[model samples]
Target chain A: MTEQLVIMVLLSFLVVIAFGIILLKDLLVAVILSGIYSLTAAAIFVVMDAVDVAFTEAAVGAGVSTIFLLGALTLTRRQQKQQKHNNYFALLVVTLTGALLIYGTLDLPGYGDGQSIANQHPQLAQHFLQKSEDEIGIPNVVTSVLASYRGYDTLGETVVVFTAAIGVLSLLGLRRRKREEDPELDAKRQCRQQNEEV
Target chain B: MKYLALYNYWIVVIIMMAGFYIMIARHNLVKKIIGLGLFQTGIFYFYVSLGKVDGGTAPIFVESLEAQATVYSNPLPHVLILTAIVVGVATMAMGLALIVRIYEKYDSIEEDEIKAIERQHWQENNGEFGISLTAPPTASS
Candidate 1:
């Protein structure tokens, strides 16, 4: 009961933060609030027995992503520009989507029902939990499943991360090459000015 | 009790829609990326919630399994979501890098302003291919 109450409070905080992120014009504050949002979500994850996920959310979502946003902010404007026209179309679209999703959830198993299909699926979740000790020899099912059973997925995820790093480096690296070329451009400009004077 | 059971899903829907609305309605590129992060997190929440069992513990194995039967929350979703969280951060980083490059090119990070600048360039160039090639790179405005 206490656990549910705590989760309820944290989830409420998440809603409030979501509203804050939407309504606030200051990007820096929004970024900080997003970190708080991730931390709150992490807390909820912990309550839901998702400790590993909570760890990753706290580290990656709250830590690295916040730093990335802050680094980007140094390069871009902090204030969101005010537009003349209201976005009623966006509001309507969001409302419609939310209503549809909520209606769909009515058919889903109740929260934390142990016999839910996802929990009892013999081939997938059950197979991992029951056989991971014998096949993978790892007590932590998530790690075994991630590193052994789903090795290809983890490999692909690593490749994706590496590609993103390379993409970011190449995208931001253009400035350094342009900087190296500046002396030549400056010298050429000086020659043009001198020739004009002559 | 029926409605209460679906509370988590309802919250997830709200958060996802908030992110979706921010992504589409906001002009700021950074804000849009933040919205994208929120949207991804909402999905993560849904998966994790699905894996939850009323009385189950985390998926780690116990020392004495034969002593007492234990219920472990589904580990598959946790594994999937772990990979997803990493991918999410990578996407955010890539998006921010693109935003920086866009700012450097057009001197603005707002989507509508960037579009307006591009349109102006298109009109000035009259459908030519060398739009950015002709204009000297300007310092940050």
Candidate 2:
């Protein structure tokens, strides 16, 4: 469809823009590009018929992550220096792995034939697509699968989120020390806050 | 052709994984974050693709139950992906906040420099003067 073509082109553009962000010298623009990247992904999700995902992408990608990256930038050097030299050995290893992965994909099922064995096995999630209404009280089959028969998996996923949150807290949420005596840092903090408010 | 859709998705994945590899291997903090975002985009693509049934209509409902019986692409993936997008933003925000702190403490986000400083601290804490008594032959020797 024409729409899918547009989505593909847009995805390519977004990837290029993301690369530009990384390749740029300034850290600030890199952080901003990260937000743009997230927004683009959100838009792509929209074309894919994934409204829920798109919403989350926009909120987290554009809203919160950029703020965090900028803060991280403040803690880092303003500009990254060019690498000392390219390591051919590392590049070789990466290329070899990539080649293998591409080769491996030849075995994968083609786009939704529905007759693919992966689609038919009883163990497959097709039950939800077929006989869920009489069993699970929910209309959304994915939700039913996520919350009911796979409750344990759902619980594991929750734990994963909890662990991720803990990691973020430990990694990022350090409490401020008493800045009363450190006039230099205190002044810097005040200036930063002022810029933020404005 | 029908196969074109599959190829399109694979291309998306390849680009995504490339970004992920950069994140994992690159020392530059900003570059790493860029990689992370690209990797996430790939995942978004995977979820969105899952909902694609050929000739499928949007998940929107019509008043006529009979008309609604026609095939429509699944909407559930879209909903799920939306939630993930929100979470991604939160994670990115938190990550950036950490990067700020890292910059403040180390004054450089380059992994090598941070590691060097950390090693120096570790050495001081452990009081290692040079090589350990039972260490293997040194390259210098």
Candidate 3:
């Protein structure tokens, strides 16, 4: 009962933060609100017994992403432009889609049901829980599953991260080089060009 | 009580839709990226919620394994969502980088203004081409 009450409070906080993110015109405040949202979600994850996920959420979602956004803000405008008109079409579409999703959830297994298919699936979750100690010799099932069972997927994910880093470097690195060029060197190059023209 | 059982899922849906709305309706590129982050977090919440089991604890095994049977919540979703969270951050970084470049090119991040500029450029080029083709046709006629 207490657990449910705690979760309820956190989830309500999440909902309120989401609304804040949507309605706030100041981009900076919106970004900070998003960080709070991530932290609140992390707390809920902890209450739900996903401590590892909660840790990662706190680190990446609340920490790195917020910093990345603040850095991006330094390069872009801080205030969103006033929209000329309300986007009724988008509102309608979002409402309909949300309604359909809510309808789909009507038949889902109740929260924390131990007999749910996902929890009892023999081949996937159960296999990991049962055999991870013997096969991988790792007590932590998540580590064994992530490193030994899903090693290739993690490798692919690493590759994806590497590629993203390279992409960001290539995209923003050129401007940094141009901005950092020495003024004396620029003048020297111009002088050389003028001498050549004469 | 039955209806309350699915409360977590309902909230997840609401959060996800809020992000979706922001992504589609907001003109600011940074806000759109933030929305994308929120949407990803909501999906993460859904997955983590699915992995929960009543009376279960975290997936880490204890030192004394023989004393009592321990029920650990499903670890698969944690693994999957861990990978997803990292990947989502990567995607956000890439999106932000693209936004930075777009701002550099267009001097504005708002989608409507950029579209208007592009439309003006298209009209200018099309008008030149149409004038040349119609001039020849009218002279021949």
Candidate 4:
């Protein structure tokens, strides 16, 4: 019972954080608020007995990503250049989607309800609980899923990474090796030159 | 309280959508990356949330330490997401690396500024040089 009360409070706090992210005008503050939202979600995961997820949320969502964003932002400017205009048609589409989502949720099972499709599936989930050791030889079901069942897919993903690296290498040769042959560089030089003239 | 768990999925969905919206709608490149980060985290949370078992405890299992083996939650999600977090970190690192290159190319990191600069660059070079000159220098090799 106490858990329920505590969770409700935290959830409200999360909603507030989300709204804060949305409402903030400053881009830096918005990013920071987004971190708060991730932390709040982590806490909520802990409340729901998802400590692993909470750890990931705290580490990746809050820690590493924050640093990455800050680094990226250093190379960029903050202030939004063009103001976004409100269009009623876009609003209606968003609203209708939200309404439909709410309506769909009406049929969902109650929170943490034991009889959820997640829990009910014996062959899928219960098997993990029962025979995870003998069959897959791994205690962690997620590992079994990611490493074995979908291992090939992850390998393919790594290949995609390699492909991207090659693409970048071929497109942007090293500075000393091959000077930027791009006429765009010339144009930027021209722009800089023009700016200097002004 | 059970109802809240059911609704938690909605929170994940909302976070994901908000992140997606920010990534797409916002003109700022850094904000777009942040949006991408948010959106990725939302999916991570969703996957992690799916493994929660009611009345469960943490999964600190040791071969020598099964004495406290209560109804512990699944360890798989934690382990899986651990890898995911590492991958995400690596990906974000690579993204920032790309942003560094973007900064070098465009001079101005602001998306709108970069766009303007690129457009202006295209017009200036295209009118003056055309294909008579070599391809413009992209980040590629």
Interface CA RMSD of each prediction in angstroms: 5.6, 7.4, 8.3, 4.8
B52 Cα displacement, candidate 3 (Å): 0.4
Task: Give the range of the ten consecutive residues with the poorest summed lDDT in model 2 chain A.
Answer: A179-188
lDDT of 4 by residue, B1-141 (tens): 545655656765666666666655556666666667666766665555566666665544346545655565555555556566666666666666666666556554456555556566457555442222233455321
Which tens-of-lDDT digit does each residue in A1-198 have in candidate 3? 788889989999999999999999999999999989889888998998888888889999899999999988988679997787899999999999999999999999888888999999999999998888889998888889889999999999999999999999988885453322333334333433443354
lDDT leader: 1
RMSD values for the candidates in order, in angstroms, are 6.4, 8.6, 9.5, 5.5
Ordered by TM-score, highest first, the candidates read 1, 3, 2, 4
Clashing pairs in 1: none
Candidate 4, residue A198: the lDDT equals: 51
The lDDT, on a scale of 0 to 1, for candidate 3 is 0.84
What's the DockQ for every one of the candidates? Answer: 0.53, 0.23, 0.37, 0.32
Off by over 4 Å in 3: A174-198, B64-66, B127-141
- The 10-residue segment of model 3 chain A with minimum total lDDT is A179-188
Maximum-TM-score candidate: 1
Selected candidate, larger lDDT, 1 vs 3? 1
In order, the Cα lDDT scores of the candidates are 0.86, 0.61, 0.84, 0.61
Q: What is the TM-score of chain A, computed separately for every candidate? A: 0.87, 0.71, 0.87, 0.73
